[model samples]
Target: MNGGAVLLPYRSNRPWLSGRDRKRIAQVLVLVLLVLVAAAVPQGPAWAGANLIANPGLERVDVGGFPVCWEKSGWGDQSFTFGLTGPGHTGANAMQITLATSPNGDRKAMMLENPSCAPNVTPGHQYDLSVWYTTTTANTVMTMFRHDVAQGWVYWTDLATLAVTPAWTQKTVRTPQVPADTDQIAWGVTIYGVGTLKTDDYAMEDVTAPATGTACSAGDACVKGVWQVLPFNSPVRGLHTVVLKNGNVLLVAGSGNDPDAFAAGTFTTAVYQPTTGTFINVPTPADLFCAGHVQLPDGRVLIMGGNKAYPAADGSHGYEGLKDSYVFDPATNSYSRVNDMTAGSWYPSATVLGNGDVISLGGLGEDSSGTVATQYFSQAQQRWLGLGEAHQTWNFWGLYPSMILMQDGRLFYTGSHVFGNGLPGTGSSIYDYDANTITPVSGLQNKDQRDQSMSVLLPPAQDQKVITMGGGNIDSNPDANRLTDVIDLKQANPTYTAGPLLPTGTLTGGIPQTTHQGKMYVSAVLLPDGKVFETGGGLHNRADPVYEASMYDPATNTFTAGMAVDPVPRTYHSSAFLLPDGRVMAVGDNPGNGSFDMRLSVYSPPYLFKGARPQILGLSSAEWAYGSTRVVTVDGPILKAELIRPEAVTHSSDPNQRFVDLPMSVSGNTIGLNLTSNPNIAPPGWYMLFVVGTNGVPSVAQWVHVG
Candidate 1:
C-alpha cells in the first residue's frame, strides 16, 4: 500500500479469459484516470482550499482541505438539508440522522424520522448517537426517551439538564432501563422554545440502553460558577463609580449598605493603591451620590453629580441621582466644587465633547420622571446652560439613553424614556447646537426600540466606520434580542464606518473597543498609546461571552490582545481617563454577579514606554486574490499594500469582493507570502484585507476594491 495512493478493493483472477478482461479493465482505468487528470488541471488560479463550512447547508463535502456547505430559505418555511446519503449495513443497529428547524422566529424543532426506524430502543443494549446542529437561541434541547405499546412513552427526566454549551455539544445518551419500557425505546432531540433553529446529519449507531442497574447518577451537570482570577476580600456595597487614578484606583460608593441604624458615620469613598492592592480613605463630600469622572487634557479629573445613599432603615435613602458637579484634581489629590446645574438632576449623562466641555444630557430631575434637559458646559463662562430639551418634551430616566456625538458634531439621544428602558417614544435624536440648525436623522427611526444599546463613532480614518453595540428591546419579543449585528454607515452616511464583523464567534455583548498603550485597557483611557480604549460591555445570552479586552490600532485598522485579561469583568461600567501621565480607569455599575466588592480597577502599561504608530499593510490583488503574484510591501511608515488577487480580470463579476488568503513566511525585512489561488475563480472583487503583528495582533480589515 503506497501512502501516495489509496487502494480500493478489486476482484479478478483468470489469465486467458483474464487477458481479455484485463484489456477492458485497462481501458476503463485509463478513461477514469484521464477524467480525473483533466479535472486536476486548472485554467485559472488554483483553489487552495479557501472555503470553510460557513453554515451547515445541504452540500456537505470536503475536498482539497476545504469544507463547503450552504443554506437556502423559502418565503416562510426554512430548512438545513443536503444531497448525500451513504449506503451501510456492516455497522450495528444504525440510524441516519441530521438536524433541522421549523422556520425563522419559530423556536420549535422536529427530528426528520427515518422511514424504517420506529424510534425504538431495547434495554441492555448500547447505542451511539450523533447530531449535527447549530442554533440562534439557547432554550433548545436534545430530547431522548423510551416508548412502549402498553405504557405510552417514558421520557428521560433530565434531558434538558444534559449540556449547555452554545456551540455544537455532542452527547452520547446511554439508556438506563427504568421500571417502565424494557423492550421498546424512542429517543430524539427537540427544540424547546419559540425561536427557529436547525440541525443536520443526524445518525445513531449501536442504539441501546443499559441492562438494569444503570441510571444517570449525576442529574444536571451544566456549566456554572464564575471564573475568579482575583478576590476582592472586602465587604463593600453600592459601588456606583470606579476609576483608575494616579497609580491607584478609586471606588466612590453611593451610600447603600451599612452597620448603623440611622447611618454608620460620614459618607465615605475608598481609594485603591495598586501598589498594595488595598482600599484607603479618600476625602469626598459627605453623602456624595452617584458621580461620573472625566480627566482634563492637563490631567485633572472632573467628578460630576450623583444622589446620596441613606441607611436602609431610613425609607428616604437610596440612589438619589443629583445635579451637583465637582472637580477632582489628581495632582492635588483633592476634590473641589466646580458648577451646579441650572436644574435639580441626577443620572444625567456627562460626556466630554471633543472641545473638552462636558455635555450633560437627560437624567432624573426633582420635577418628575427624568428631565429631557440637555446642557453643555460653557468653558468660557464656567457654567452649565440649557442647550434644549429632547425633541419630544418628557423627563427621561435614562435606563440606557443614547448620548452619542456624531462625526458631524451632532449629539443623538435615544432609549431614555424612563431612566430604565428606551422605548420608541423615549428614543429621540438631537444634532449638536454647534451646527446652527439641528437636523434629525430621519427614516432611520428606532422602530425596534432599545435600552442599554451602545453607539460609538467609528473614529474617522482613511475608511469610515460607525458602530452601535448590544441593547435590550423596548417591545416584548425576545427574538429581537440580537447579540450581534453590523451597520456600514459609510455607504449611507459616508463619514461613518464601523469595524469589520468580528471573526467567527459573536461579539461578546457587541463590545466596540479601541486601543490605548501597550496594554489593551478597557472602560476608557488615553494611556501610553495615543488611541482610545473601551473595555467590555454586557451582551445578550446567545452572544459569545466577552471576558477579554482588545487594543484598537487605528493606524493599522486592527485590535489585538496577547493573553492578559481585564482586571475584572465589567459590562455596564464607566471607563475613562486622566491624561498627561496617561492613566486609564474603570468603574462598573452592576459588575458581574452583583458583587459590590467588584470595585473600581485601573490599568497602566505593564511596562513603561513611548508609543509606536500603527503599521498599516494593504493587500494587493495580484499577490493574494487569485493571481500567481505573491508580494507585499509596506508603503508609508503607516500604510502597507500587497497584490492579493490577479486571476479575476476576465471573470469580472463583482470584481470588488474577491480575495485570497496568504501564508506568511518571513524572509528578512521583506515578508514572503504563499499567495494561494481560488478554484471557482470568480471575477475578482475588492480583496478584504488584514495584517498580523509580531505581537500576533491582527489589524482591522480593509478592502482594496478591485477594478
Candidate 2:
C-alpha cells in the first residue's frame, strides 16, 4: 500500500480488504520480514553462543584508573602495581600488573566480585574462558572464582596454567562443570613471579551444549577416549608411583616436597588397589622424597636416595641428599633397609639393566653439588657396591636424567632432566659403565630449557628409538618450548631429529598459533594399543599446569591430537601410568603454591569403548624365558599381543618402562606368542601381557614374568 493508504472498492463504502484478508496479509508480511532478518544474520550454531563477560575489553575505566568491573587482587607478601595500559588486544586499553619482588605471593587483575560484572553461569555447564596477554614471567594461571549464593564470592579452581608469551598471544581454557549453587563466575590471569603482565580482550562463553555433542561423542569414544576424575582422593601425595605386580599402585611421598615434613620425619607411603578402590598405608623407613626407584627382578621395588635435609630458609645451605636405601616388598607391604649408596643422592636416575642390576646416577649429593659417583646395586647380593667397585665417571648427569638402557648394555641419557642449566657437552650422552666413559650425543634443541621434559622409548622395544618432548628451565625462568626430538639409537651415529609439535588447545579470535606453547612435567604412558598417551604438565618450573594431551602412535611416528584432557592440574610431581585394565591413571600435582592435589584421574582409551574386550581364558604358563613361545587361550579371535614392563615412574622418568611386542600366530581362540629373544628388550621383570582382539580392544592384562 503506497503512502499507507487503504484502497476502497468502487461500489462499496468499506475498505478494500476484509477482516480475514487483512489478517492474512499481515501474516504474509511477517513471514517475509522474518526471512529477510534470518538472511542478514549469521547461520548455524555459530550465532547461538556469545561471550558473557561485561567490560571485557578493559576499555572502560573508573575514577581509580583501573578497568571498570575488574579489581586488583593478590595474597602473601608481595610488592605489586596494577593499572590500565594502552594498545589492548582489541580496544585502546588493557590491564597491566607488575610484580617487583614476588618472593612469597602473587598478583592478578580479576573480574569484580559483584553480580553485575560477573558472568552468569548454569550449574553443570562448562564455559570456555580466553584472554589475550603478554607477560615477562613464565608462571601464570587462569584463576577462577565463583559466586556461591550463601557464601558470597568464593575461590573456584584454576582452569589452566598459561605459557609465557613475550608477544601478544591468546590463551584459552575450558572450565570444568560449574558446581551446584554457583550462579556466576569471575576469572583473571595471575602472575606468581617477579615480572610484568598485560592482559585484555577477556571472553567467556557457555560451551557446555556444543561440547556435549562434539567435545566427546558417545559414538566416538573409541577415537577420543574419556577421562574421569575419581571420586576419592589418594591417601599419599604420590610423588612416586609404581604399578605393582599385584595390580596395586605403590605411592611414595617421603617428605613430599614439604620442608616441614622433612623436619618432622613424616614420610608416608601407601598401596592403592585399583580394583577395590582401597588404600593400605605402609610405614616409610626414610625420607624417600626425590629418590630413585625401579622394579627388581623379583618384583620388589628398590628405593634409593632422598632428602637427607632441607635447604636453609635464608639460602645459606641447599638441600642435602640421603645415602639411605630401602627395598619395598609388595608381598608384605613394608620397606626393608638396604646398604647405603657410595654418596648421598637426591633426584637420582635408576635404570635396571638386562642382568637385573641397577645403576644409580646423577642427583645432588649431601653437599648439594651434583653427585659424580655412579653407584651400582647388585641384585644378587642385595647391597650397593663399595667405593672401589663403583664406577667414578666424575660427570654430573644432572637431576633425574632420563637414562635409557640400550640393547648393547650402554645407557643413553636423553638430555631430558629437571631443574638447573643443562650439563656441559651436547646435553645428552652415552655412558659405558664398564669403560667408565661418557660420549655426548647431539641435536637436542634448547637443552637447557628441558627441565621436567619427558623422554620415552618408542615401542616396540626392538626399534630402539626415544622421543624427548616439551620442557622449560625453572631456575632460569624461561618459556617452555613445544619441541619434540626423536633419536634412533639403532643408527650408527644416533642423533635427535625434530618430531611433531605437542598439540595445543584452542585459541581466541581465530588467531593462527604457529607453535605449541610447550610445557614441563609431562607424563607419557605406553598404552596396550601401541600408542603413547601423553598427558599432564606445567609451563613454569612447577606452577602453571598445561592442559594438553595426545596419543602418539609409534608405528607412524605421528601424534593423534584431541584426546580427552585430564581435568586435574598435573604439574610438579605428577605421574601417569598404564593400568592393567588398559586404562591410564594420573596422580599427584604439587604446584609452587605449596599445595598438593591428591586427586586421581583415570583415562579410558577409545579402544575400551569400541567393542567387547578380548578375554584371556588360559595360559600355558606364567613364566616365559627369552625367545620362548607361550600359548594363550582367548575367548575370541586375537590380532596381536604385547608384554608391557610395569611402570616405576617418578619425576617423569622411567628408564625401566618398555613395551615388547609379542609376535603372534592366531588360530581360532588359541594364540601362540613368540617372546623377544633379547633380554635388553624385555628385561628381567614381571610384565602385563595383553592380547588385542580383531576389533582393536585389548584384554585385561595377565601377569607374566620374563627373564
Candidate 3:
C-alpha cells in the first residue's frame, strides 16, 4: 500500500478461492445476470428494427440499375452504381449515388421513392432512420421527403447531414414526430462537386408510443364517419365518376360542357383521395368527355369513346364521335393509350360481360341515334372488337341506356333508356354474348313509358329482377312517367308489370304545384342498404327542377322521401353515385348543354345518424374471383351483405352501379360470403363491398375485385 492504507481482503465466508478469485467470480456472476435479463425480456420491432424499404440490400436489380419498387430521378444530375467493393451491410452488393452540379447551378439531388406503398406516418408515430454510408466528403445533406396526402411534398424541416468518417460507418438519424398526412415515403441525398455516396441497409421504422386518445366507448355510433365536403373542390366537374379500388374517386369531366376545352386539349382528369381530403391533378392522354368507362377484371379502367368535338347548331344534332379508347391503371397511377374502337360512338353506354370483356354500344353516331355497330372491348387483346352492328330488330339506342349482364351469360338491354325515341327500338331485349344473337324482351304494356327512366337489377341479384322507373320523352317532354315497371328475368317469362310509382316530388318542392307527377331525367343509384336512391329530375326538363330526393325500399316496394332534400338541382347532366364511405355524392347538373355547374353535394343517409355505425374492418383480399368464398372481419353486427358495382355516371347513364346482394352468413364477428359466380350478378371488376348491420347502418365500403 502506498500510504497508510493496507490492502483489505474480501470478507467472504466461503474459502474455496483467494481474495482475487472471489472478486473475479462475482464479476462473472453479474455479467451472466445481465445476459439472462436481456434474453428473458421480450424484444419487439422497437428493439430489433427492420428495414421497411423493399429490396433494401440492393441485391435484386431488375435489368435496370435501380431496385424494384423504387422510382429514381433520371435527370442526369443523378447517377447510380451497383455491386460495390467488399461486403455491404446486408449483402454482397451495395448501391452508390454521385451528384454533380447541374446546369441550373444547384447541387445534384436524387430521391428513391416508394409511393402509396407505405402507410401514412401519422403524428403519433416516431421513426428512427439507420443507414450505412461511405462518402467522399462529409456534411453531405440528406433529407427525408414525404409526399403528404393533402400537401404535395413536405420536408423534415432540417437537413440531416451525414458526418463522413475516414471509413464506412453505420449512422442513425432519429426523426421528429412524423406528420399526420405523410403518405409517400422518400429519402433524398444531395451532394456538391464530384462526390460519391455509397449507401446500404437503409431503414425507416415506426416506433410506437403509449396510446393518447379516448378509449372505445361501449356505445359510439358509426356516424363519426360522416359527410365531409372534401377540403378541395374538384377542378373539373365530376361528370364521369369511377370509384377506384384504392378508395379514391376518379373524376373525368373531359371538357365539362365546354366544347372548346376539347380542342384546347385541356387535361381534365383528377383524383380525389378520401384519406387525405386532397385532390391530385392527373393529366389525361385524351379527352374522356362523354366517354363510357367500366372497371376491367385486372383492376384497370377501360374508358372508351370520347368527344370528337362536333357540336351541332340545333344542340340536338351535335354528332362529334370518337372511337379511341384508353386504360387507367391504378397500380401505376397512370393512363395507357389503347387502340381505337371499331366505330365512332358518342354519348355511349357500356356494360361488363361474363367473359371479362366489356360490350359498348349506343351513342349518337353520325346517324344521330344509337351507333350501328355493337363494339366490345376484349380484355385478352386489350382492344375493342365489333360484335357486328346491332341486330336489325334492335334500333334507336338511346343516349346513356341501361344494359345489364344477365345470370344466363346473356346481356339484357332494358328497353328503357334515357334519350332518342321511346318504344320498340328503344325496347328491351336479351343478347347472347356467346352466340352474338339478340332475343327481344316481351310482355311490355307501356312500351314508350321508359323514356329517360332508370332501370336497376334488384338486390341479392339472384332474383334477377329489373326495375324500370319514371322518365319522359320529347322534351323530357310529356311529364315524367309515374308508373314504375318490374321485370323478373329469372321468371319463366319476363314482362314489365306495374310495381310502384315514385312519390310526387312536387309535394316537397318549395313551389306549390298542382301536378304531383315526378320530373324527367332522374338519376338512380343502388344503395348498400338494398334500397334504390332516386335523385334529380325536372317537372319539364328544368321548368321545375325537383330538389327533393326519394329512396325506394325493395322490401316495402315503396318510395319514401329522403331525410335531407338536396339543395343542388340535378336535372340534365346531373349525376349521383354511392361513395365508398357509405354516403351518396350528387354532382353535375347542367340542366342543358353548356349550362353545366360543378356544385357537388354529398348526402349522408339516415343510416349514418341512425345509431352506432358498423365497420367492415378488414377485407381478406383486394381482389377475388366470382363465386369465391371470402372471410370478412367486421367491427359490428352485419345482417346483410352487398357488393355495389363502382359507378360511372353521365346524363341518365351509369355504366357501372349494378347492386348485387352478396350471399353472406355471419358467424360470430366474421362474415362468410360467396362472390356470385355469375358475372351478371356481379361483373368482373372492382366494387364497393359493404355489410349492413341489423340497424340498417352500412359499414364503410371495402373495395373487392370480383373477376
Ranking by TM-score: 2, 3, 1
Worst 10 residues of 3 by lDDT: 1-10
What TM-score does candidate 2 reach? 0.68
**Model 2 worst lDDT run, 10 consecutive residues:** 1-10
Query: RMSDs, each prediction?
Result: 22.8, 25.1, 21.5
Residues 81-187, candidate 3: write the lDDT tens digits.
32344466668766665554433222422334323123235553555556677878653555566766676764432234455655677655444344455655566
Task: Judge candidate 3 at residue 592 and give its lDDT.
Answer: 51
lDDT of 2 by residue, 1-707 (tens): 11011111211133666888766655554454344323322222221268777677876554345665678889978888888888888879988989889878788789876544667787756666778999887667677889988878867644545556788998655554566778888899888888899999988766544321122236657577889999999988999999999999999999899988888889999999999999999999899999999999989999999998898888877988999999999999999999889999999999999899999998999999889898999978989998788778788888998999998889999998888678887899999998988888999998888888899898778679899988888888765777889998977889999899888752223233346477788899988877899988876787767777899986567898889888888888999999999999999998778999999999999888767888999999999887566888999756557899999998878888898877553445676676755587777989999987656688999999988
Per-residue error (Å), model 1, residue 106: 56
How should the candidates be ordered by lDDT, best one leading? Answer: 2, 3, 1
lDDT of 1: 0.37
Q: Indicate which candidate wins on TM-score.
A: 2
What is candidate 1's lDDT per residue for 1-707, written digit by digit as tens?
Answer: 11111211122223544677666655554455344423322222212222111212222222211112111212234343322332212211112223355444222222222111223343333333444554454445544444544656444322221223334444433222222234433344444333334355444443221223322222221111012233454333324333332444445554533334116554566655645657666676644444444443333455555554332445544344556777655456567887776554555555545454656655555443455655556554556665452232334435324454443445554222222345344134454555434333333224253344444333222122334333444234232222222233224432222343222112345354332101111132322222334444334312223455444444344554432345454543333332222234444434334333345454444322222223444334432333233434542221122222211000001011112233232222343333322222212233334443322223433434322
Q: Which has the greatest lDDT?
A: 2
Segments in model 3 whose C-alpha atoms lie over 4 Å from true places: 1-232, 312-317, 366-370, 386-396, 423-426, 443-446, 507-509, 513-516
Candidate models: Cα lDDT each: 0.37, 0.81, 0.64
Per-prediction TM-score: 0.42, 0.68, 0.64
